[model samples]
Target: MPLTKEQVIETLRQVNYPGYSRDIVSFGLIQKLDVSDEMIRVHLVVRSTDNNVAQTIKRDVEAKLKEAYPAAKHEVVSEIQEPPQFKTTASETAGKEKFLAGIKHKVAVASGKGGVGKSTVAVNLAVALVKLGKKVGLLDADIYGPSIPLMLGVDEKPLYDGKKIQTIEKYGVHLMSLGFLIDNSEAVIWRGALVHRALQQLMSDVAWPELDIILFDMPPGTGDAQLTLSQSVSLDGAVIVSTPQDVALIDAIKGVQMFRKVNVPIMGIIENMSYFVCPHCGERTDIFDHGGVAKVCAQLETELLGEVPIDARIREGGDGGKPIVAMDPESPQSKVFLEIAQKMYDKIENQ
Candidate 1:
């Protein structure tokens, strides 16, 4: 009723690594193979930091083993074996240095809550950076609701240029979103591990042309998925987005704390929808109550980058697939984004 260790190893042996032609089990990377009635447990070692290939192998092996041995349940635990110091020769060292490649800086835009205009800020910030003559890339790592494609007005799928996936270009900014890979009508339902793999692909599988900056639109939360993300890449900094509401400010603090826990710098905080400007009277109102984020940032001894007023035009512009900053470069809302962009540049450049 239980699969023996040899059968487990042989089953894994049939699954091939995508980049490498070798089977996983024969590579001597399979360990702790155990079997019980109707259950299979195993551990796998993936040497090197090539997470993309390792994940692919893991997924394929799991799917195949479950299909071939339909009556049995299997669970595989995997770990990456760090490459030895001496094995990293001069040439290898040079190759690995190209991880971020041409990117001068990477900023992750995150929030503690959803529907707080986190993606909107991320999209506008990337556009703002491009407007300032910097080559930019906006990676929509928000695996669940990837609205970057919708915000940027690019409905076309990215071109696969032989070796790497080419990011779709729009508004002078290279764009990549999970939305580009799936049908617009479909939904992405993935657990934490799957989300991590997808994020890894977006970071490593794609060829982001020499970029001055790359903005990541991270998913909302402080869950394991977000924790795994913080551990994976070396972020230059993170900009937490929040509204003027007290609950939102609390979550924003948690976002800042998460980055601080992982040693990533908190570039600053951006207050979105801080206030509303009446279209009919041109009067400003603290719709959500103003200065909440700025006060919080001050208490934490961090910078409050800038405040984005709640303007109907900004919402309209986003829904219409043209970010407010791009649609009306001279508008008041646009000015706020521009100021935030300038301050962010100064902060990172000084570092």
Candidate 2:
């Protein structure tokens, strides 16, 4: 029997990338797969620059296919994408530099995995900074799942002047997000190259006002988008957000290592949903296993800036398109965000 595309995909699904739970096929690594007359041609793009990782993936694909079809001829074409370009002297790079000239600092709030409240942290941190009397801008770089527009209560589409995009403002923070550009039901099905281009435009083409700092709400994982942002603009530092669970902490380590490899300074880690405070009695419970983040931070020698308890008000505020800091600045949950923002600002100032 001749090999089918479905069969080939099923075989390739067994090939997992190093250090990640997702396989190559599901990770969007298998760009092209052609099978005809027992000959299989596979084209894949891996995000890592490591030659060993690429060779391993190639070997795994070929081995799996050969095992499935003894008479098959398999050809694996693999390419490693170069990291984002950072040089600013060249004419091509000069535009990117000029785009970021007005902002004094650029910080990325990132996580190695999803469901860590990374975007929530990014939004509140930006708002808290605004409360502290600094001119701030927030860019939602999580193209696949942008939530800043919803979180900040901005539902209207952004207006673009001929040359630059006009950002929507709410609660004293200038905001831009992919959510504002597309309808809620619309899905973003962009390739790595297109994603990189969209992110570049989000930073450079947006008519961002002069500000003390701009916070980038980055998408989860150490993939193309993360690399694109780190390379395209000069980042002052990055803040890693994670829950206190062992699984989240494990992935948070990867987030730290990724920033270090890109030469971006680690601002510190924020443990979100660290605990739950009973509304009736005010008793704090270790809902997700407490102190895991602190232990990881100690081992990594990075500061554990603060811990935000799991609060229903926080969730409600986010769902209502109003962050806690902006909705109720006097609340305990809001104060936590404010303190983290101040710590971050102080660290940047001292450095």
Q: Give the top-scoring candidate (lDDT).
A: 2
- Predicted structure with the largest TM-score when compared to the true one: 2
Residues 185-262 of candidate 1: C-alpha lDDT, one tens digit per residue: 888889878887888788788998888899989999877657655666657899999998777876786787777766
Q: Kindly list the per-residue Cα lDDT of model 2 for residues 41-160, writing each as its tens digit.
A: 999997654666778888888888888877878899888764453334566455447566889989999999999998888989999999999999999999989988888888888898
TM-score for each predicted model, relative to the true structure = 0.71, 0.74
lDDT of each: 0.80, 0.86
Structural RMSD, model 2: 9.0
Candidate 1 stretches with Cα past 4 Å from truth are 1-98
Lowest-sum lDDT 10-residue window in model 2: 82-91
| Pairs with backbone N, CA or C atoms under 3 Å apart (clashes), candidate 1 | none
Q: Candidate 2, residue 203: CA error in Å? A: 1.1
Against the correct fold, how does model 1 do in TM-score?
A: 0.71
